[model samples]
Target: MDLAQFKEDVIQYSKQIGIDKIGFASPDVFTEMKERLRTQQELGYQSGFEKGSIEERTEPKLHVPESKSIISIALAYPSKLKDAPRSTREERRGLFCRASWGEDYHDVLNERLYRLASYLKERYPDLQFRSMVDTGELPDRAVAERAGIGFTGKNTNLITSEFGSYVYLGEMITNIPFAPDEPVEDSCGDCNICVDACPTGALIQGGQLNAQKCIAFLTQTKDFLPDEYRGVIGNRLYGCDTCQTVCPKNKKKDFHNHPEMEPDPEKVKPKLKPLLSISNREFKETYGKMSGSWRGKKPIQRNAILALAHFKDVTAVDELVRLMKEDPRPVIRGTAAWALGKIGDWQGKEAIESAQMKETDEQVLDEMRKGLEFFTENV
Candidate 1:
């Protein structure tokens, strides 16, 4: 097929197969992105990211050594819900992002990309191709922007005209040359609403993000919650969506009506009480296919405790006290102690006194004492 005819056919077919938007980018876009990765690594913005993301982001060529043209595709995820839950209150009814509300997108989108690659391969027997969703070394957003898919927003998410920023990106790197698309102009135009709306200062300045400061990173992390980020965490049990919710571009999309992306009824806003009771087996079974499940239940449970503490719910004080004294995880105990103090009731005080008397871990004891002082002295 001729180059122009091939481009038009492939682009049309991509839309028919459920991809919302498609763009063709040249390999040269990687040059500036390479420098940005190196700078971020040097400044320690990536200290906690998996070691592989650092290596891969720095080297896109690793995915397709001789890649000449890249096709970027976007799939819309959901954002609406029947109800929104408070930070600590887990309810049967709640709102969940559209992206995570359905069957795993990796399996769905990768299968689509593979089919596209296979079709092209059959036509050109000697064609070379490499495809990836969110899992690989290539900067998917950058490729998308360069290919005229959309502009990159200040929140570091890719935004398209049709899907807004509520889309997931995937790429197909190929040897056969296709005409590259034009890079879309930035549409943010002095709108700092997203940056100002961030509960955490993750959107450090404009399009830059300090991943360490991002609530999304904090909720998903397996390590101890950083003391500095606790208050800013608010009720976000997983990733924070405040900035995205405030974006004007996102406001134009009809998330509830998008059938491809639907929220899981169980996860919309899980109650803290039930979350505390979740067994490892139940957690795995319920969340096994979720994007939030990557870190296991420990982080979710810890975040639940933190959220309860943030709400300062007195009814949860008793449970927090029990968890402080008996919970197996040190992180959970520390957060429980903090929550008890936040409650500041007679039961909360008594729980703190009992925990402080028996707690052996210096860190736990210290947090317990602080929890006690926060209630008594602050009261």
Candidate 2:
């Protein structure tokens, strides 16, 4: 099969299969990025997730073995509607990010990529290929950047001049070799909109993100959240998009109006109270199909309680008191106690007094004392 014609067919098939952007790249485009991933991993900037698999992520050949070319595909999931009303307390419960409010993209993108891969197989019966969304050991964004689909932006998201960073990336690693395109020139010139908008200082430098400080990753991790990040968590129950929201490149693009990617009207910006009361069974049923549920109900529930604490809702004090005593997760119990204290209600004082006496971990006990102090100072 002719390489040029094969490349064109791949692009056409991706479009027919419903991908919005398609491009190609050589494995070598990863030279600098491989080093960066390694350095980031060593410094613990990868949040312990990259897991010494840096070599595989940097070398496509290690993944595909005979991979001579990579065809990168992008699918857009833009927010078409203006954010719904979240001004009232009741409306803020169970809120999910726009990308997660619908069916999971892993299912959607995999179904499309499999079809495209099958087409490639039928066309060139001897070709070997593998397709993946974000699940594989491959460095997806690096491959996408090399393919000229986009450039890595200061926010650490790949932003295309056309689709911005709102697009989801998937790729096909193949034995067939096509001439690769040069990487696109970055257009984020002197702009720090994403940097300035970050509430957690996750954007440390241009094109660099410390995932440890990233609210997005923090919300996704199943482990206990570090103490310093609690106050800045605010009302976000899942991922943080403040950087993307403020980018000029993202602002000018047409609203992402895909029906399948629409944010649930009930979830866009959640109220804190009802969210706190959701049962584990309810959490599984509501968020099981969504990507934000990767960390499960505990993190989202914890985030809600912390957001309530941040808001200092005196009305939530009784609920916090109950959670402080009843929740099994020490972190959750500690946060509930902290919120109750921040609210400084008479109920909070009782809850803090009870938790301080019963709590075993030094951290939880310390939080209990802090809650007691918050109430004592305010009382």
Candidate 3:
């Protein structure tokens, strides 16, 4: 097989099948990334969501033993929401970040990767390859960078020339020795915009991230949110976009190349009040298809309760009170109490005091006291 001609053919086929950008990379062990990840682990900055040990993550050959090359693909997602509903005084809305706006990118990108594999298999019937999305052990940004798809920005995203940072990334590791493409030139010199713009200071000075402090990571946790990040998260229901939205490379770079990649404005930016009481069946029916729903409705509901407090919507006082008093989950009950504390409405305050009488959980009781204390002091 003339590998060069076949690679061009593969690139053309990727364009035909909706892959926005594709690049080839040599399957060499990622030496630099291994060191950075070691430093990240030493600093206790890991998100705990990482699948494998440092070696499994950086060694492409471990994922596919015969891997001689890798194929990295990028599919651009829309940044600006078209005809998005306004967050008003009466009925405020919470937002899912741009990455979660469309269908679960995992499904979309994995499907595209499967198709690319199928095209390759048509000729090289015995080719050994493995495809991976975010859940895979491989570090996607590192793969994309080596494949010449994009450069890793200080915000830790693959910022492609054509699509900016608003792109979904996935990769395929195979034994085929496809010639590698040169990585995109680094254009982010002296740009501290994304790092400075991070609300929770999650972005460290040297482009490293402390996942514990990242709002995007914080929003996905099922437990009660840490006190400091509650205000910083604002009305985000799923993920935070502060870093990416502020990046100069991403300005006016929204791409609508794929139909499935478009967001349902109402769903992604839904009203916060109803979300607090949404039944499990209803929650699944509405948001189940989106990638943001993978963590289930608990985190979203907790964030929605907090979003109500962010807006200080007195109209949601009753619902917040209901959650504080009657919710079974301590995280939800406690988070509602915290929101009530933030809102400081009479009904919300009274509800917290009443709930404390029957609340047996020590943690919930502590949250209840915090709520009642909101009125005693200036805060």
What is the per-residue lDDT of model 2 for residues 1-379, given as tens digits with 9 covering 90 to 100? 5879878877877787688888888865367877898778777788665533767777777767888888888888865546565444433343455557666888878888888878888887877888877877676788898999999899888898877888888888888787898889898999988898898898888888889999888877655567788778777788887888788888766545446666665655656777778887877786677777777788888888877777777778777888888877788888787778777778778868876777787777777887888866875
Model 1 per-residue lDDT tens digits across residues 267-300: 7567777777789899878777767677788888
Sort order, TM-score high to low: 3, 2, 1
List all candidate RMSDs to the true structure. 2.5, 2.1, 1.0
The candidate scoring highest on TM-score is: 3
- TM-score, candidate number 2: 0.93
Cα displacement (angstroms), candidate 2, residue 346, comes to 2.1
Which regions of candidate 3 are displaced past 4 Å? Answer: none
> Which residues of candidate 2, in runs, are more than 4 Å off?
80-83, 89-95, 255-257
How well does model 2 score by local distance difference test? 0.77
Sum up the clashes in candidate 1. 4
